[model samples]
Target chain A: MDKSIPSLAQAVADIPDGASVMIGGFGGSGAPIELIHALIDAGPRNLTVINNNAGNGHVGLAALIAAGQVAKLICSFPRSADPRVFNAKYLAGEIDLELVPQGTLAERIRAGGAGTPAFYTPTSFGTDLARGKPVAEFEGRSYVQERWLKADFALIKAEAGDVMGNLTYRMAARNFNPIMAMAARTTIAQVSRIAPLGSLDPETVVTPGIFVNRVVLAENPAQEEVLNRQEAVYP
Target chain B: MTNPAMIDLEAVKLTNAQMAWRAAQDIEDGAYVNLGIGLPELVAKFQPDGREAIFHTENGVLGFGPAPAKGAEDWDLINAGKKAVTLKPGAAFFHHADSFAMVRGGHLNVAILGAYEVAENGDLANWSTGAGGVPAVGGAMDLVHGARRVAVITDHVTKSGAPKLLTRCTLPLTGVGCVTRIYSSLAVIDIAQGRFVLREKVAGLSVEQLQSLTGAKLHIEAPVTDLTAAQVA
Candidate 1:
């Protein structure tokens, strides 16, 4: 019953070159920076990374992209605050991008986790984005068929976790983390703090322990401090 | 949204806030609105009194207030754009799926968005130009297609002076035939029956001048009237 926390290196050591990974976050808010930094330092190449934005500034996934670690990026927003690295790589044909609409991205990840292979959504219907995709009409409206988005591993960030891996997220930081956790074969969460099993309330747990395989505490406490101050106002 | 006061309204013809203010007048009272990033976000701040429009951000915050005051930013609280914002009373955070359901399920009454181009036929192309670039399409596709009414706010022309209201969008579209109205720096245009009709224009601008600047034909059904300063204020 013991799924002990591992060192950041051991946590991501299983990730190999060309593995499809889902990294969670809207920007840097809920990003698991320490684990991502470790992954970058571990130096896996040609990886396909899925996330919301490319990355903000020169940190997190951006650092991984800047290191030339990623071969493809499947994201909703590829352009962020400073997207020069991705822009340059994309324009030069050094990397590839598969842009999905945000809502569809979330639902696809959710669908992937829920064992649904595909679903019809009205989003992006009748547009170039819907081009060449399977289309269906229900009640006189068009819908594009989007397949489930699954990955070999999901790297996520959470506010807190119990020893059993029950997790909770802070405010908007919960963005893509929970969905990615469900959508991946192996889910590793980087959390601010770990509590005892009985200390976490069952009703409040956002991601039940079954979905998360490993939990690692953030290397930098200051990052957690910033999030703490941000969430301080809310319960 | 950036401060509208900083913009040279005369040079750009209309400030972003003024454009938002113009759009706000059309939004009815007690409407559930979703404001997209950039200029559309300013619409919430300018929402007139007596109209209690509940704002929704796709990242799962609803009843969100305007941007937090400088130095008072809370990292935990952010809109879908990843910018820090204050939460209004009764504001609630839910799962991303539910937030999007409110959008895709057509629970939202109106969605105000920024656009790259809008064709005369009401096709919206705000996500990307599709010219060799990253082409990040966020929730624009769902918001335009799902919202009951879609309103676009944008510059009349690009920085390079290319008209954005076109005969047909040469760019990748976010949604087809989704735009109901357009509030631009130069004029308030409505898309009806596949034509861009002039509703009102900023002072010192004429329908002929608008036609010269617009790539598509401008249909003037109503008497062209000056957009008074008080109306924008």
Candidate 2:
């Protein structure tokens, strides 16, 4: 109804260098590939990408990585799928990295949305995890709660959306999109399909419209890039 | 149905006090385990010595150790509830994406969790009771489907004197038939023949009472007797 946030390129064109962002997905399952491509084309430099996985060599977020736009990466690097072939440019002293454990990564984002600055946890104690962190105890045991994390923008992928930005994800695709929607100051959604307002069942919307700041309808259904091979080849 | 073999009836029953030791025995050396929030969280204290299984905290630390001391708290290394925890040697830190991958990737061997309701068919619904006040399932979805073994630890009955075990759970489901074993205050039940087969029970409770409390048919194992920690372990 409100003229769909202009355009994808226009939306991301203003993002400054060194901007912090949270890109939602589980191993490239739910990333906003179209918007990511737009950023790649628009050529924003020194961008810090926070995502589950760097998309495989050719598509998804890898477009930016390949285009040499991402200057730093703050995410849970894929132990299973690395963007080595695509990311070699950055890994060779071209970019910065801050790797967070998967669980702690989610909590930091969630805690940021919950309005908490920081909390303690017991995940990292004696090993290299505690090497640089401050430590303490509870009930004779130790704990370390990480600080909350927030981003200037959060780019997410959803299965369907409405004019109000009420969104839903298909099956496992829901992954981290819903949470990333809440953890950023400006959350943008790239969806496969768009529906009229009130067309979607209220109960089924996983992400409420309030959290979404912009929405883009991806046109390249044929080239809907993702990390997993099955997703790339399907349809 | 009952097993009429000659045996000590006491050995079939499990008391509340023996739960920790019995649960500890389930842990083998070098198994990667996740201790769920609530009662299941207590399992960390009961782990057997000389066994060095890695513990993962959903908050992001793998190779998790015991809780920490006062004035030495690290705000960034906490559990799902923002609680503090200790890290074991060689423990690694990463974002939740990788932590869940480890879980969903079949890297974790066992997950000890608390349950609100368990069905005869192994349907687990521990997330949202849709109650007036309580936290809903936040990470239970990933935990249940990812772990190799899902062990439920809880009391047999509700505080209102009702049973948490039901004929079919009316609460939101966590997974269908995902539960491998159930450890309760009065009994430990295992999945048998598509329903619960009583592995052991607590002292002084009757079979009829157990059945009534379960609200479902349960097959009592042979050689009925009270359960010691050894039997459950």
Candidate 3:
């Protein structure tokens, strides 16, 4: 079945307010900038965004937060290189923040995708972050129980994608894209190139077509860091 | 009464680069290591001549080489610190889940991190200072326990000259009894039996002088070696 979408706007148009979204990126590397801007233009509100960093500057995720679309942020690090946008909103009580350790966050997403309800980990056992979590001891060591994190939608970027939505990411840009693709109900991928069917090698497809729902072509996507370096702000 | 030997010993504290170099000497070859941001990152530059430590960045890629030249950087190819990097021949990329699986599954050999405070009992506190501001923990909480061995590299004292190696961490803790070794500017200490076991100290510094600067009692188990590093230009 062909899952290719015509435009970024149409792909993210159905993401309503109060939806939980997993935006793929570690900092700005794998972030789907065009799709995020399209979501902003679509004007969703009260979004709960799960990402690694809050946002760098006033371009991609920062722009979404600046647009007052995000009601809460579920992330590992909310402070970025230029986190003035998120910081201003969070301090003013305009948005809520749920901070998870980076590895735990990744595991939760993986567990959510794999249909595991919860798992025990030693990541945040004795820290402030582990407060109020269920703890269990195994062989004299304590482990905290962390629940799975599933999202209503996932916006991800890929280097190449086929019409069936089989995707391949570039270098370190593959960080959260593949896992977020599996964890979300509807995964929307923006690819730099839309390869022909049977073009992407089966052995090399990081995210298979079964996990992705919509694939859009963004030939020349704007990079968040470069845009921030230019001090570019969205409308 | 000014003791000239004491003054000379005080002036010879290891610089940050030298401390990093000293820490690099301990990493076993063919080991998968994670170097935290800041001072710990410098350990990558001083890997011994024959030994190689495969670097792991939480962002995804492993076996990454040093940073690319000024204009040669690919923003997509970056480290956990979000700085552009180059991939080594054996480098491989994976999703965040698998990257962390290598960490949380104890597949990594060592994790070297910078710290705010380390208790004599092996507790680490590097995430937050508790001074009313945004708190970002990143991957520190996981790395401390995930890696087989956790080590800290930091200045012996704070900028105001307060001891960082303490009997108890006053700030919030990152992990409980996780750190095994510390590579500080003043000394190389190990946490064994809940005590700070002095293994090495700055040359010419007396044991009494080092203990005066430490917050906790420094235990002398055996003959302490002089902490020295070959000068790197």
Candidate 4:
């Protein structure tokens, strides 16, 4: 129902401090840089951020971490090539880190989005990472039980969207954004362009409007170009 | 005095590209392969001619091509390493759940990865050092368990010259009894019944010399072939 938000500032205004936020990005490919900047300017402290890597360079989530807004980071890879921001903060004990296997992290969020409470997985079944977690055995194989991971808000970036908030993302940029959108209480998508309703092919829609609460047009359509220019970052 | 049995240590180590080329020969046609980051990624570029294997990346692109040439990078098209990639003619992009489901569901025929250590029993430890430092475990855990075959392409030794083929992995394990074969700079080894079987070695490198550098005991297969010199170039 016309869930368009005109400015990034207005979009992130209601996100309170200490919110559990899921950010969408895979090495800056699908990162919502403008929305992240808005979140930084909005100054919400003590945030719990969930993403793939810590951040790439200084543009996306790294800026938020650098600004000291993030209190805890739940991610798969907490170290990047230039992990200066996350590294410095983590070394200083300024932030808490939770490193989940990339697949399990995605599954947990998917479970949350689908309303599944918990699932047992073979991923991390025998490692120290599985320590303290409940283990279940099936067919003589062990699996670690992981609970669903939901967020207070999910800020995502999409290649295209409609006024109704249906989204279509680019190649790898589609990684965590769609799942995070479904798992969050409120999902705000930053898009390069918004088309008229029904203009986008229904089959091409990766995230339907029902999951998206609002859509904010990104300030830079070429924001993702930064991803290619980035040197091979550590995982 | 140098032992007559020990080959010149500095003369015959394979390059990462050569290891990748060797690894590519193991991939069967009509297989679904996942090329892990680093050395394994190079396999995509040197895939065996006349072999057709569909490549999958955990970040949701399948039918991926080799790394894009310089200045041809497309940010939207990237592998797990965050390096720009190209999409093959039949490439498809899906969501994270589906991408990993392809991984965890045993749809992938092979997953070739770089490793910190691979135990003789087929255990792999590549995710972390087990130190108190920040742990970074990506999709290796999922890939190893789900892929039908797991191959590792890594340097033979650590920067300090410690062998990576170990009796037991001292670091946190990514998967136990998961790796099927190992393609290293020095040799191509297979794990069979908890032993490292040497199948191929670099020219001039003797079994005794290789064993001295290896942390695990080795069983040499008959007629160990020397890697062709042209493949190294």
Provide a comma-separated list of chain B TM-scores, one per candidate: 0.90, 0.86, 0.95, 0.91
The sequence of per-residue lDDT tens digits that candidate 3 reaches over residues B122-198 is: 99999999996777989999999899999999988887667899999999999999999999998999999999999
DockQ of each: 0.54, 0.04, 0.85, 0.71
Task: State the TM-score for model 3.
Answer: 0.98
Q: Which scores greater on TM-score, model 1 or model 3?
A: 3
- Top-TM-score candidate index: 3
Model 2, position A235, has a per-residue lDDT of 11
Ten consecutive residues with minimal summed lDDT in candidate 2 chain A? A226-235
Candidate 4 residue A141 C-alpha distance from true site, Å: 1.8
RMSD, one per candidate, in order: 5.3, 18.8, 2.1, 3.1
Give the top-scoring candidate (lDDT): 3
lDDT of 2 by residue, B19-99 (tens): 756776788998999888766776777667798778887645678667689656443345654355667779875445456
Q: Order the candidates by DockQ, highest first — what do you get?
A: 3, 4, 1, 2
Question: What's the DockQ of model 1?
Answer: 0.54
Query: Model 1, stretches more than 4 Å misplaced?
Result: A219-235, B1-12, B159-162, B220-226, B229-233
Clashes of each: 0, 60, 0, 0
Ranking by TM-score: 3, 4, 1, 2
Better of 3 and 4 by TM-score: 3
